[model samples]
Target: MKQKWRNFMTVLVLKINKNRLHDEEFVRPVTDLLEDFKVVDYREVKNLDFDKVIICGTALKDNEYLDNLDKFSWLKNCKKPVLGICAGMHIIGKILGYDLIENKKIGVEDNKYYLHSFKIEGLDESLEVENFKGMLFHPEVLNKELIKDFVNLT
Candidate 1:
């Protein structure tokens, strides 16, 4: 018999929660998007050996996760492609030296909204997936300058 795929894909989910209180905020879409991928917690983050990594979204925006931020220093030097959603984006912003601001004044409403349209700047059209219009949760806000470190990709 011939083998088609020889490797397993594992994603190390860098959870920012201090306890299990915010398990729901962790990335679940990762499993839904890839059938052959494994998502693990941050138990061995410093000694990790994963192909892809996901910095999970959080429920708090007061920078509470900062208590555990030191563990994620690896992110600054990580070479793999990263996708930060909501608070995850905030973490990435924090890593990129963006000051955390109070987005709480924006109010709380995480309901999904239709994304009228999006324009991804650099990705090839052939690599495009169906663009999602509506966001399912209230996204955490970061400074406008956070885009500087990113390519046409963020």
Candidate 2:
């Protein structure tokens, strides 16, 4: 008998929500768009083997991940490229010494308005700190092609 190997790229998706309901709104879309992905809570991400990391966003009111910033300290020393989405952007911003501006928004409509709604203290349209990069907007919703291209490029 011979052992065979399958060539599939795996991308790690760090879930930022405390409530599972938000998965359909945030996590599931990214996982569905990718050919291969693994969704795990942010706290359990250390020592995992992944080609890249995508920090998934959460509901507008879900700030549970913010309470546990220590779990994300590993990101500072991580060599692999990391892409942070909405809520994930705040995590990256907080880890990078940026101030988090929390706002109270009711109801879910089109999120495109969020792009211009609030600003992270010192972040910009594109983030390139050391090896990590982040975008304030949701690429999966705004530009699905970029996500697909990223998978192919990486």
Candidate 3:
């Protein structure tokens, strides 16, 4: 018997700053979760063509992190699924009419310490995982107003 090949592919958008890729502790977990998935740098691709593209880390302007959001505007119009993690979430929020601002905290905390929770809004049963908990370590966060536009999936 032969194993079947899965066509699903995933691209990870990593920010390059000072000619180096941003390092985040969650990277390993995220990559492990998507075993066998293809990972591509967002800067190398001329177009947003993929089954799914995950945006991660901060891409500040002129910092070699690809801060030019206009270059990837096609994302808003594409049907392809997107998963923004941490800073990636902030980028998505900023693109979708929400402001991303700085918070006061820094450093990582265990999931038990933070107890972060999110509420699902404007979504039907089709989008499951309504309410759940997850670990987050960012000084900035998505504006409350934009919460309605996104479904919280842990």
lDDT of 1 by residue, 1-154 (tens): 3212222555555565455655553445333333344454544465557655555555543346666666567777876656554555555655666544443322333332111112122321112122211122322222212212221232
Candidate 3: list runs displaced more than 4 Å: 1-26, 58-66, 108-154
Best by TM-score: 2
- The order of the candidates by lDDT, greatest first, is 2, 1, 3
TM-score per prediction, in order, is: 0.54, 0.81, 0.52
Candidate 3 lDDT, tens digit per residue, 51-111? 5555544333322333566645665665655655444544455456544444433334432
Clashes of each: 3, 0, 0
Model 3 is weakest, by summed lDDT over 10 consecutive residues, at: 111-120
Model 2 alpha-carbon drift over 4 Å, by segment: 1-8, 102-118
When sorted by TM-score, best at the front, the candidate numbers are: 2, 1, 3
Scored by Cα lDDT, where does model 3 land? 0.39
Q: 73-92, model 2: which lDDT tens digit per residue?
A: 98887787788887777778
Candidate with better lDDT, 2 vs 3: 2
- CA shift at 57, candidate 2, in angstroms? 0.6
- Tell me the whole-model lDDT of each prediction, alpha carbons only: 0.43, 0.72, 0.39
Instruction: Kindly indicate the candidate among 1 and 2 with the higher TM-score.
Output: 2
